[model samples]
Target: ENKAMESRLRQAGFPYVRTLEDFDFAFQAAISKRHIQQLTTMQWIDDAFNVFFLGPPGTGKTHLSVAIGGAAVDKGYKVRFISMDQLVSAFRTESTDPKAHRALRAIRKADLVIIDELGFLPITRTEANQFFQLVNDLYQRTSIIITSNKSFEEW
Candidate 1:
C-alpha cells in the first residue's frame, strides 16, 4: 500500500499541497461549512458521484478541492488533479497521439479525478465536444470534482 500510495501522489498533479487544517473556513462564509466538512469524509468518491465548486476568484475553490482530494489520497484512493485547460489540450491530440492515450488512461484508472478551472477561457466547439466525451466516459464510473468560475448554465 505504501508503494502504491507513492505512485498515486506522483500522478495526482496537485498544484501545491493543502489540507483541511490549512483552510480557513471562518473567512469564507459563502461556502457551507457543514457541506465542506461532510465532503472531507470522501464518501461521495465511494459512490462515484461528482462534486462541483463554483464561484469567482479567491473563493477557495481550488483550496477546497485540493484539500478534499488530499483527504481521499490519505485514505489510499487513486486521485488525479488537472486543470481543464490541460485536459482540453490533451483531448486535442487524443485521436492520433499515443501519449495522449497514456494520459487519458491514467485518468481512467484513478478512483478520484479533480478537474480544476473550467471556463477560465473559452473553448471552441470541437474542444467542448471532446471534453464532453471525457466527462461522459468518467461519469458514474469514478468520482469527478469540477471547479469552475461559471455556473452549470454557462457550461
Candidate 2:
C-alpha cells in the first residue's frame, strides 16, 4: 500500500505536496471549513462532478485544489495535476509529441484530474478545439478540478 501510494503521488504531478491540515482556514475565512471537510470525502469525484475554484490570484485556489487532490490520491484514486498551460501545450503537440501523447493518456486514465491556472493565458482556436474534445471525452468518466483566476463570464 505504501509503494502504491508513493507511485500514485509521484504520478499525480503536483508541483509540491500540500495537505488539508496545512491549509490556513482562518486566513481565508470566506471559505467554509465544514464544506471543505465535506469535499475531502471525495464523493464528488466518484460522481464525476467537476469542481471549479475561481478567485483572484493568491486566494488559495490552487492550494485548496492541491489539498483536495492530495486527499484523493491518499484514498487510492488515480490523480493527475497539470497546469492549464501545460495541458494546452500538450494538446497542441499531442499528434507529434510522444511525451504529450503519454501525458494525455495518463490524464484519461486518472480518476481525478486537477487543472491549475486556467485563464492565465489566451489560447488559439485550434487549441480551444482540442481542449473541448478532451473535456468532452472525459465527461461522465473522469472528475476534474479546475482553478481559474477569471470569472465564469470572462471564460
Which candidate gets the maximum lDDT versus the true structure?
Answer: 2
Give one digit per residue, the lDDT tens place, for model 2 in 1-155.
99999999999999998888888999999988999899988899999999998899988998898899989999999999999899998987889999999999999999999999888999888888888888898999899999999999988
Every model's TM-score: 0.93, 0.97
* Residue 32 displacement (Å), model 1: 2.2
Worst 10 residues of 2 by lDDT: 125-134
Compute the lDDT for candidate 2. 0.92
Candidate models: Cα lDDT each? 0.88, 0.92
Q: Which 10 residues in a row give candidate 1 its minimum summed lDDT?
A: 2-11
Global fold similarity of model 1 (TM-score): 0.93
lDDT of 1 at 29: 82
